[model samples]
Target: MEIKNNRLTGATFVEANAYNKTAVMKPDAIIIHYTAGASGNATVKLFAAKTSKTSAHFVVSEDGTITQMVDLNRKAYHAGTSSYNGRSSYNNFSIGIEISNPGYLQKIDGKYYTWWEVKKDKKTATPEDKVYVGKHRNAVTTMTYWYKYTDEQIKAVKELCQAICKAYDIKEILGHEEIAPGRKCDPGPAFPLDALRADIVSNTKKDLNVSELFKDAVKESASTSLTIGRVKVKLNFRQSPSSNAPLKSSPMAADTYVYIIGSDSTGEWYNILYEMTGWMDKEFVEQDNTDDNYDGELTTNSAMLYNDQKKSRRLVSDLKAGTKFNILDQQENMFRIQAVVEGWASSKYITKI
Candidate 1:
């Protein structure tokens, strides 16, 4: 955790996008950023790309590996359109540290997923301690989770900050949120901003409690079985109770049997078995004590399979009287059918068996 030759030798130095090209100025502040991507390796490469308009002095991975992108004397184009303490441009007076994080989690239906659509499963998933309401960088406060920044990451950041301050005489350390406020929410609530600063100022090191930071969720309770409901539309089953979670490679079709624990707080996504228990939207899917499995028989000879509801949709295939197809979802007069003839069929032409 030391700086030599004007660079953090512990960090891999690679020049990336250029900004603030004037005579290198001694940076007095540090601006923290989140890569908002899945992995640190991928994010660092993007910064190295000439077309990428962003670059940071250093990047910290989820595993705590550090990569230096630009020299401390040189400015990194990270804090865009940002100002702090009478300073109009931050890059000119600050060294930027990009933290590797799957920035935000978006819940679509009931499942939790990352912005990159990576599924958040219990094995690797960390339940958010408390849901944040109100505007996030102007995003309507949908239920969001605090990413579990690892202890390794925490120590690394502390060490890096200590090293940077010792070498450059930096006066204050701050997050991107403090600088941009409503326009950004990086190094978010999940980050212990106040404590981090305190540790640096007082030089008293303390480790943040992971349990106090992340929600401890037991496995979905027993005595309840959740299966994907029958629906006319295709449903996205995710690894977590968020639509933002990585989608189960295949859409959950109607009548697809799914196991459930319970609905998320929103009472939308129902957990099921996929990559060892994820979430599926409750609307187009469902969870019930009894599995809704049945057979439907066509009553008419000229019945046609459609991509959507019967009358107004284009035909998907043709079917004959006395034909049997497994039911996926059922509407009043149209049914989504699976098997050899997989699509929507007129309910009048089919009878439940």
Candidate 2:
């Protein structure tokens, strides 16, 4: 994962001819994105086309193959009219890396589908490979089936960002969604965007490695029973499970039901998430009540079970017409039911026993 001559990204450049001949760019940041297209080669070719009007410096595939399209020393027309830190039009000050991903997937029928209306198997689409299911900040769509960044892709991006930082004196790393906010949402939460910058750009480690990633998943996930926590008081939410890991911008306020990622090595810290990953002292965090009283039965066999309120949350396992479940919670038009399978469904599609 070395950059040579600001052109060859680890001995590969996909001949990116569709770029502006601007004066040399003294890059200060890296903006990450997802192609939302089919594959790496297709995305590379699309950016190479002069009419595409969008291009990235590099495109990393799902399997971690790096294809340098635009030279790192030049500005790639990736982020349009994006601003950050007083710099408007982010393309001028950043190198863009578009990873090949489907972004958020829409599950349909007994199968899962990409935004392009391409169908894939449920098992293949949302495998527990370096991915986590969660909600996003300031976005209507909860990540029912998040497109995960592969382990190989994660490592490659880490090395590539480190190289770019050193090559161009890059000072910051950001996502397309961050720079453009309401207008864009690439490289979403599931991709570990923060963890990438923490590990490579800022030299910190919010390590979501194999051993610790799923260590407490069964015990902490919605599968076992959602473990909701409340902060006793204000607590420092550091990046990694360490007291010294660099506090995230936000804090765990008193009595907030935080989303739990996992626990620390010492079990003294509860790796939690409000918007992003951070650690708070476990002692101050208390497991709040998770009991609910309603019991119900499905009135119809065709009723759809979803991961969330969004009916796009199609679950593979279906409950028979007379199946029973315990209602954990209820929102405006959806009911969170469990026992048979933990998920949400339209209240109209189910009935209480």
Candidate 3:
């Protein structure tokens, strides 16, 4: 589990069929993904095929075996149309790791099956204990089922990520869903992404520049006022809070949720955040002011809420055990909840009622 000359030693190397042969990238991040296939060998074979357009640096099998499909320094076409932290096109800046998984599953006739397996009436049903049910951050509220990752695979991933972070000074570890939400949901809720990220970053913080990067990120993200608003009608998202302000892009559709940051002097214009930050007319944006809708409660004796999700240490309020809260939103392990206060808390400490 050691990185040597832009490759992992002691891991099987399988040349990928497609990758950027010219451009070499100094990666600062790692993106985790699920194969959505049966095994790591299948994905390895797919990447090795001449017709396959997708490739990744590494793939961890169900039994914890590691296989390297592409060189670490080369750009693998794993992230498509992705963006995160003001950076777009992640393939050029990050290493991609594909884990063997069937991804989300559907239950029918008391048997759990993958999406394709259900259509074929496949008799090989996943064990009940291997299915994880949870709400996706992008989804509104309803829970979804996904295949669980084995402890062995998780252990291998953690070790591999740690080695990469140490060798390349990697700063951020992200899921594919975070970089390309709505379009992808691999390495779903069943993966312990947050814990893994925290563990890796915490151990590498002293040597790497991740601490400073995280601080800057937290500062930038904290600029948002944490006000949720709904678009009342289709209108242009302007660069400024005036009618003469230039539009950022196409008109935002009605019912789109935005984070209201500030407003103009007249209070008729609101600065908001959707896919991008811009100003929208206050009259056309409805602010959320709903009553308490507690569907979860605190399990810990004490838990602190933060104004935003980026800064883990920033405190808003401390709640005692049995404190009821409503899950307004989620980002990784952090839940934007409305409990005694409207702020973010670790989902690890909250259980659904």
Candidate 4:
């Protein structure tokens, strides 16, 4: 599957009545939800109603059929009064996918029945295999019965997510339950949310290497002083310069390297390029003051590792060719290397990695 012009190529497109038509939305996250209804067509029809007042981008049926209700570029009213990683109102920057499932089911007389099914007086019991018994992440002690997602539906959602990530710089795959924990629980415990996220996001990062991304960003951006920074702690990579901005993804691990391209007006947030382009707090990043910061490899057969950068340097050792070391500091025509023997090496004999 492929996405073109913010729409999936082989999916059925149906316009929804509820969405932000005027507001510009650059989605970087996907929020998964359950229809809580009968089928994908039912949810599509509901979204098409003039009085629906709520909408999602896509809906997946049990048989793996997908119906797109809203353009991927538009804001669909999926996540209501939501927040994640200190950012609020997820609809502004996330695409929503509604999987067709009955959601949490009610067990009566050892038979599982959807709340909607019971309301219609039909009272048809769901199959045992199709029902999953588990506790919602938001629940304290209540064990709930949730409708299990079909294998076909799961495969469809995975492919759809992968396609979305390939089309856009999608940084996160979240459940509606995660974004609005107390208020909502959808694509619930029955769904393999974490596994799907790990599979899709891991592949996305592999498809787009970080250093290659940095080079592309640097080429397109205006002139700025580029520097190196190491994350001092696990830090949030935000879409904007504020703490309230949506997170690019999970927190970057401590000691992750990033390119500091620029800063916000307050100078408290540093615009960075690493696994992805985002903003990080300046306080949590250790900026490399030197102009050059990189790993170096010795080119000569016998390169001298010196203790000091002086006319008459103290010899530390003779390093063999292709010896790799991190550049710790730099002086005129000399670089301090963190090797077996921490010392200086001539710049001419070292090549940047």
In the range 212-325, model 2's lDDT, one tens digit per residue, is 222233224424333467788988888787778888866767876665657888989997756455788898888763322336766775465566776455552344555455
TM-score of each: 0.52, 0.54, 0.63, 0.60
- TM-score of model 3 (CA atoms): 0.63
> Each model's C-alpha lDDT?
0.64, 0.66, 0.78, 0.78
Candidate 4 clash pair list: none
Please tell me which predicted candidate would have the highest TM-score against the true structure. Answer: 3
Q: Model 4: per-residue lDDT, tens digit, 1-353?
A: 88899899988999999999998899888899999999888899999999989999999999999999899889999998766543468999999999999887766667878877757774589999888977655443345678999999999999898888777777567888766653466887899886786576456466732134523433433365356788899999999999999999999999777778788999999988874679999999987533222367778775776658998665544565555556888999998885433568889998888
Error of 4 at 104 (Å): 0.2
Candidate 2, which ten residues in sequence have the lowest lDDT sum? Answer: 208-217
Single out the weakest 10-residue window by summed lDDT for candidate 3: 211-220
Query: Candidate 3's residue-wise lDDT over 230-342, tens digit each?
Result: 78899889999888998998999987766676788898999776656789989888886432334777888777767678853445445667655557898999888754335
* Over 4 Å off, model 3: 205-211, 215-353
Shift of residue 49 alpha carbon in model 3, Å: 1.3
